[model samples]
Target: MSAEVRELVRTYLPEFPIQYCKSLVTDTTQFMSIDYGHVIELGDVHYMVYKNEAERRFGLEDPKYWVKRCHELETGKRKILKLEFFETFPVQVGKFRVECYRSPDKESRILDIVRGDSRFMQGITIKDAAGRNVRVLEIVNGRRLDLTVDRIDVEHDVYFREHLPGLLRRYLEAVRAIGMLHRHGERHGDIRRDHLYVEHGTGNLCWIDFDYTFHSYEHPFGLDLFGLGNILVFLVGKANITVQSLEGMGLAERLEGRLSSDDLSIVIPNRIVNLRKIYPYVPEALNRVLMHFSNSAEVFYTTTDELLADLEPCVEALESEYGRKPE
Candidate 1:
């Protein structure tokens, strides 16, 4: 399948080198549902082009829905149906706001939350060269911030120490971004370390991946806080505290056997063990922050503001103690 995808891409884009090809799958379902086309990467740009007969064979609608909607506004009824089939590529307006799904409803919901926020990536609709309506978002040129840290040779203690302050600053900024979302009564339903990015050249921190985000009016704020704490753990520990690791440490089995059904008590202890094993040099102040939020204490932060207040001083203390002097 991958070979076929590569060949198809070569036929269409002969000028560009096919860096890689992956079987594109739809996320709207729990079970894996392969899409009609493969997501191909040529140099730095990526495209999702379907095969010639894919639309017919798969009964897929036009991926470019906004294009037709523009025509509707000009001639026919302006009332666009809220159907799921119209969403296609990332419509490039002023910036690049890529919608991963075909549902306009999801795009509208996400835009309503993050459209104007500087901390979050922004998006807008625009007309393409074919006079079709499309959406675009501000492109983040850098790789995931965690990837940068992960690439660092941890054995070179001096290198790790030199970069620690900058990593800490980015971490704090990420926490603040999440806090801003919470302040607006929203929750970043997915808060993994990969979702936070450090912009290339500018070193600006921004959050991405709002596909799972939703209003948090009635939801507990602890999920985001806990996620933030885990991110901090990843930073200070210098390694991911994954579920597989927890299970290896026998923490998962213990939690399953001992913990109550509703109790969210298993995260912190497992994190502490992993942190100690992989990155025991994690500072006391930062360690406390991770512990406080992930522990089973009832007094976990109710607002990101509270978490930020506690985290800022810790950041300062770490920088003062171990930060390298600027060149």
Candidate 2:
């Protein structure tokens, strides 16, 4: 068990503690039937499983234990249980190729790195009975960032005027937290708008889903940077303003500027990275920050610090344009 788990993480998760992997010994395969009143132990901790909406509606034939909500009997607290899953995907950006994987071990390591940081979702890692790692995370009380952004009812100009700056600041906080991951020699691995949770009470932007893993000959944090760029576009446009997203709204003549192949993402070209052409009033500096990830971008962000550096001035510019003092 020790040898097998070590080989798995050492290959898939870089800089991970192999001995830690060796200690965890059981896969949560039996957890599928965990219904209401079921009591299970993970490491030294025990949890009483309750019926989530999916289980209540569908009657417990669920296979995915990656997102199970549980009530900790010992601590008498609610937490989420994530079982180990093995997934690998390939992503291409220009000439660079990246292989992304879902590694629970890596996420466990990151849980240690960001244990107390409220800017991120909280979680604890422990080994299950069959040498598998399980992540018991806080039940984040928040809405998905994408959904929260989607619920905003405003035109592009109004959103830009009233909302974008604040959203950008919060996103900068998240990007900086990703920098913390980099500082610890890890990446967010999966960075989607949905992975972000906007806390209900505090309005703090919390990051979830740190189980993504990839190592490349190109820049290590390159894909993370790419994901950051995608989120930036989402914030700037108030949603993911793709050509398809904007299709019914106008013809080519309705846009303020012409679209070129360069204005799109090199990997996913349909996403219009250059927001200035459509919004017209989007700050040029902010648009250039977005373009850093576009097909036309001569160079990409080498480090999170670089990305943060580029955006700081854009924050100031945005505040000035909105006639508000920069925070």
Candidate 3:
């Protein structure tokens, strides 16, 4: 990552201990990496420093200070991330009372023992100064889902355009993982394409960024749904209105001067037409899911289970259509 990228990440996470340091031989911008010195450990869990501008925006310094901030927040008070403070650190930052932090090691343990989906991340852990630990996940290799490849393309050796069906299947598997989180009453706060890692050889989708997951609340599942739609749109080569575009359009013009959440939802639709128009090959069942996801007006699927149920039939139908079998 470059200084600009580090700044961008810092904008979201102000306390991220790593700073934009030296350039690498690789053709990428300089960005922060773990300082290692700031790490702290507690009860078998490791934490890494994390901070963002939202801490000030929401006046949530006290909330962010707690070892387990999610558990401490009252569900009735916060509806997932309707407010700004509960934004970037999407999933559980610490073992908060309201939420449970999934260890990167746990996922790694499964990957190490399991023979399938070998593309998942291996064992890695990092601790931070605030004792706010998180599973260090690899950033997505290509373009961020919300931006067109041309706009925010990341040059990487791994590309999977040639295997469309394979790509879709991998995506479905990754959704199943998200479904697991949903089953546990948690919603992945960020589900964009850039958050998903593609195993170099297998071309499988690996879900990353469990930082801002919403847990056990009557919160709208819209964020996850919207993110899923964004991923699908990107997989097929389309752009959704991203933060970059929002910045470019001038927030006032984009929002028509309505800065409220109600107005913000309209921004993406205004810029990106729809994913369906971009990929005709997208199955009808999947399309229905996308439709529900893209809907800004209604709360369609209350949980990932509901969405997965709707998708099950589609997966089966596709498998049967070409005598495909799960590998």
Best by TM-score: 2
Instruction: Please state the error at residue 76 of candidate 2 in Å.
Output: 3.7
The model with the greater TM-score, 2 or 3, is: 2
lDDT of each: 0.51, 0.76, 0.42
For 1-327, candidate 3 gives per-residue lDDT tens digits of 446434433444344444532221111011133222222233333222232112222233433322221110111120111111122233421121234343433443333332243333332334333433333333234332223233434321112223333455666777777666556545565566656665544445666544454453544555676566556555543334443465664543534443333222231534332333333465666666655644243545556667667766765665566445332
- Least accurate stretch of 10 residues (summed lDDT) in model 2? 51-60
Clashes of each: 12, 7, 26
Ranked candidates (TM-score, high to low)? 2, 1, 3
At residue 309, what lDDT does model 3 achieve?
Answer: 76
Prediction 3 global C-alpha lDDT: 0.42
